[model samples]
Target: MLGIKTVFTEMLGIDYPIIGAPMFLVSYEELAVAVSRAGGLGTIPLPNYRTLADLKKALESIRKATDKPIGVNIHLSGKFPWKEQLALCLDYGVRFFLTALGDPRLIANEVHACGGKVFAGVVSLEQGLRARNCGVDGLVAVGAGGGGHCGSIPALILVPYLKEKVGLPVIAAGGISTGAQMAAAIAVGACAVIVGTRLIATSEARAAQAYKDAVIAAGPEDIVVTDRITGNPASWLAKSIEKVEKQPQLGSKRWLDIWSAGQSVAQVGEIKPAGEIIKDMAREYSEVCRCLKNTLVP
Candidate 1:
C-alpha cells in the first residue's frame, strides 16, 4: 500500500495523505467514493443542505458508493445542528470529519464523544493554534490558492509556518492539483493534502457543464475574489466575476447566482472522474518517489 506515515492516513484509514475537500456544490457521494477508492479521504459538505433529512439522504447516498472511510464537513457557525450530523455519523460509523468556518472548540467534545476525529481548516497561525487548543486532531492549513472563503498566504508558507507554530498534523490545501504538487506539500511540512478545484473539474462533479467548462477555461488572472458567491470571501471564475461585475443594473445578484471556490481555480485543465483523479495522483506520486530516490542515491 502507498501509505503516508501520517496521522491523516492512520486516522482516516487511507493510504495516500490526500483528501477531497467538502466542495459545496460539487462534493457528493460519487466524488467521495472515487476519492476513497483512490486511497484518500473524501468529504461531504453539509452547509448547503437545508434539513437534517437532506443530510441524512446525502450520507445514505455516500454509503451506497463506498464503504471506505469518508468525512463530513461542518460549518461550525451555522444554525444547522452538528448534533444531527454527529448522531447520523455515529449511527453510520462515520468518524473522520473536516470542521471549518467557525470555532472547533464548539463541537470538539461532542465529536470526540462519537469516537470521531476532527481536522479543522485555518488561514493564519493564530487560527491554527486556536484549533489545536480546541482539541482538533489535526489542521487543514488552507492557504492562498484554496477556494470558497480562503486565506491570503500561499500553502507553501502557511503549511510550514503553521507546523512550526503548532504540534498537530497539517493537511495543506489551496492551489494543489497534481501529484507533484502533493509531493511538494508533504515536503513543506504538511502531513497530507486536500484538493477542491481539482475535483471540481472532475467528471463526477455535481456542477453544470457550463460551470465545468468555465473552470477549465480559466487562467490565474481570470479569477476574482468575490464576496458575492456566498456570505463569505471566495474565489470565482471570470465569467462569474463578470456577471458580478456587471452587477445587474435593474436588480442585484443574490448569493445563489454565483459560482465560487478558492484561488486555485486555474490549476486544473479537465474534469475527470474523482476516482480517476485520485488514483492517478497516487500512481504518479508513487512513481515520482521511486524516481527521486533512484536519482539521489545513484
Candidate 2:
C-alpha cells in the first residue's frame, strides 16, 4: 500500500519508485526520456555510446525531450573514460547516477559534491555494504534473476538482507515487471524497484526487432545465465546461447546480435511504447495499493 512518497522517489524527484534499468545498447535517449516523462526514472547507459560525442548528443536529446530529472548508468569496466563520462553527464544535468562493476567511492564523492545522488548496482550483500562505505546515497540490489550482470541471490532474500545491513534506500532489481511485483518488492522493504527486461520490449528501446521478438517469445525457462558475452555471469536467452557460442570472437556481429533478458519477460505480452508501459504500471500500482489498503482495514 506504499504510495509515491518513498525515500527513493523523493530523492529522485520521481512520481513512481521505479527505474528503467539501463541496458548496454538497449537503453538510449528516446527510451530514457519516455520513462522519465511517464513518472519513472529513465536511465542512459554509458556503454551505449560509441564515443564522447555520441554521449553528448544523446544527453542533449534527452534534455530536449524531457524536463524531468534523468539518470545515467556507468559500468566501471575501465574500458571507457569514467571520469570524463561523469563530467559530461554532470554538465548535461544528470542528477542521479548508477554505478556497477567497480569501486564507487570516487564517483560517489564527486557526485555528492555536486548535489547528485549515487546508487551502486550491487549483486550481493558484500557489494551493498561496500557501496555504502563508498558513501553512495543508495543501493540497487540486483538479484540473481536480473538481466545483465546479476547476483547469485534472489530478490526476495537480497532486498531484506540489504535493508537490514546496508542502512540505505534499496532499489530491488530482478524478477520485477508488474505492479504486483513492485508491491512485492516494497513489501520486502525495498524503497523502489528497477525493471530492465520488460523495458527492452518497449518501442522506444534500441534493441533490434529480432531481439525484442526473442524476448517476447521467451518464458521464465528461456532465461539463462552465461559468461560467454562479457566474460562475466549475465542473464541471456537460452535460444540465443547457441548462436552466441558459434561466434568466433566475442565482438563478432553474430555475438552482438545475441539478446539478453530477465525471467520477467515471460509476463510481457506485447511491445508497447515506454510511456505507455510506465503509465500502465503506475495505474496498476495505485490499484494494487488500494486493494492492499482495503485488506488492512479488514
Candidate 3:
C-alpha cells in the first residue's frame, strides 16, 4: 500500500490523499464503496438519489461495504431538498461533506456540531475566501478543465494561489487523471486531488456504457466549456454540445443524455475497476516522486 501523508489524508483518516469527486449522476454507492475500500475518500452527490429513502439505502449499502471514511456531496443550490438530505446524512453518521453551488454557512454549523468536516467546492479566490469565512475545513479548487462547473484558472495556478490567499487545505481538481499530475498538484501546495472524469470511466461508475466510451474516445481538444447544459459554465464533450444544439426541445434536461467530461478524458484509456485505478495511481505517484527526487538539483 502506498501512503502519501498530507493534511487531507490525516484529516480524513485515509491512506491516499485522493478523493473520488462527487459527480452528479455518475457517483453512487458502488463507486463510493470501491474508492473508500481502496483507501481513498469516495463521495456520492445527494441529488443522485430521487428520494430520501433512496439516499438512505445508498448510504446503508456504502456502510455495508466499507467502514472507512466516506463523504457526501450536498448541493446548496436550493433546487433540491438539501436540508432533509443533510439531516439524513447526519443521522447516518456521515462525517465528511463536500458542498457546492451555494453558501456553506447554512450547513457548516450543523455539520460541525456533529464533529464532521465540510469542504466547499470553489472556483475563485472570492469563493474560497467566502467559504473559509463560512467555517469550511477545506476547499476543492475546481479550476478550468474540470468536469462540470469550473473556473477560468488552471489547477496548477489555482491550487497554489488558493493556498496562499485562503490559507486552507486545498484540493486541486481539473485536468488531473494520472499519478504524475497528482504529484504535480501536491508539489504546488494542494493537500489532495479530486478526480472526476477519470473515475467516470471506471467499472464501478454508474454512468452509462456509452458515456464511458465517449470519455475514452475523447481528447483534451474534445472538451468545451458551455452554459448550454445548466446555464452555468460547465465542461462537456464537444459531441454532447453538438447533440444539445441539434435538439432544442430537451432544454437543460438534455444533459441527461449528453455527457459532461473534463480534459482528463484524454488519459482514460479503458474501463478499469475503481480499486485498480486508485492502486495504480498510488503506485505511479510513488514512482513519479522517486524519479523527481533523483532529478532535483543538488
Candidate lDDT (C-alpha), each: 0.79, 0.87, 0.90
Q: What tens-digit string does per-residue lDDT give for candidate 1 at 1-298?
A: 3655676777767888888988887787778888887778888887757788887887888777778888888877667787676788767768877887677777778778877888888888888888888899988888875777778888999999988889788889888878888878888888889888888888777877878887888777777775655666677765776675567662553344466655566667777888888877777777777777888853
Per-candidate TM-scores read 0.91, 0.94, 0.96
Q: What would the per-residue lDDT of candidate 3 be over residues 1-298, giving only the tens digit for each residue?
A: 5579999888878999988888989999899889989988999999899998999999888878888888998988868888999998988778889987788888999999998899988899998999999989999999899998888899999999999999989999998888899999999999999999999999889999989999999999999898866799999899977887799998768768878999999899999999888878889999999998899896
* lDDT value for model 2: 0.87
Best candidate per lDDT, number? 3
Alpha-carbon RMSD, candidate 3: 1.5
In angstroms, give how far residue 273 of model 3 lies from its true place. Answer: 0.4
Question: Would you list the rank order by TM-score, best first?
Answer: 3, 2, 1
TM-score, candidate 1, is: 0.91
Off by over 4 Å in 1: 1-3, 228-231, 244-254, 294-298
User: What's the CA error at residue 134 for candidate 1, in Å?
Assistant: 0.9
Better of 1 and 2 by TM-score: 2
- How close to the true structure is residue 177 of candidate 2, measured as C-alpha lDDT? 90
Summarize candidate 2's per-residue lDDT along 159-238 as a digit string, tens digits.
99998988888889998999888888988999988899999998999999989989998898998887877899899898
Error (Å) of candidate 1 at residue 256 is 3.9
